[model samples]
Target: MAVPRQSEAQEYIEKQRIMELFDNITAQLVFHRPDNPKTFMIDYVEKLKESRTTQLDFPCLFDESNIESVFGMLDPTKKGFITSEQYKESTQTLGCDNVDPSPAGSDMDMITQDTFRREVKTGLKKASATFEQV
Candidate 1:
């Protein structure tokens, strides 16, 4: 069976739902660290900036720019990788509870650049899917 087109009311409701989700994400980020706090980690601050940019409608799509931004957040040392702990912490902070802390065949302590991107993209795709279903 073909899916029916969304009505104007349905579209408006979807928009409202998206707005609410972004608002909550913003509040969570701020609660974790206020704007321009000196003691706040630069990584967290950058993530906050990304979220704010997304909320401001800067193409929330997981494109090259967004992917690179998130990668930089995870690889702040510029060492080309992040620890599994960092991965877990970052995902959890962003309300992504579906990420497995320990995926098979990977060292649970050290996450390589490739692994980081793959896992993050997976999470983003899952989040998008869930949001679309709203």
Candidate 2:
């Protein structure tokens, strides 16, 4: 018996997650707002390729600024903190299923920006490690 081969489109786009590649590219473009988008994208893609070849994904390219933006969107009033519920919902929405919504060594009801960033960083690292193992 012979195994059937997938169509080129399915093999590349579905198996390789091309849509996710484009989505991340677009998100980075919006975040950076570079003067020359074409060059920026080329460089970005090159770095992504390098990271993949090295078996590293760099935590989905989320930087301090991106974390800050997410915190700001959740807090809205610059309150310096958000409720634990908000943190949980946002993390889940961001596909961080393994992250604990409540920050460690803090009141379970509220999460500060620093705490959120730290927890998210830790979680992303763990998630990346898990992905590499798979």
Q: Evaluated with lDDT, which candidate comes out highest?
A: 2
User: What is the model-wide C-alpha lDDT for candidate 1?
Assistant: 0.58
The TM-score, computed over Cα atoms with residue i paired to residue i, of candidate 1 is 0.46
- TM-score for candidate 2: 0.53
lDDT of residue 115 for candidate 2: 83
Model 2 per-residue lDDT tens digits across residues 13-122: 66565665677778778878999999998987776666666755553656679888999999898888888888888777665666864475347577888888877776
Cα lDDT tens digits for candidate 1, 38-116: 4444443455446454643222235556666776987887987777777788766554556667753257467776776
- Model 1 pairs whose backbones collide: none
lDDT score for candidate 2 against the true structure: 0.70
Which regions of candidate 2 deviate over 4 angstroms? 1-8, 33-35, 53-62, 65-82, 92-115, 122-133
lDDT of each: 0.58, 0.70
Residue 69 lDDT (model 1): 78
RMSD of each: 11.1, 5.2
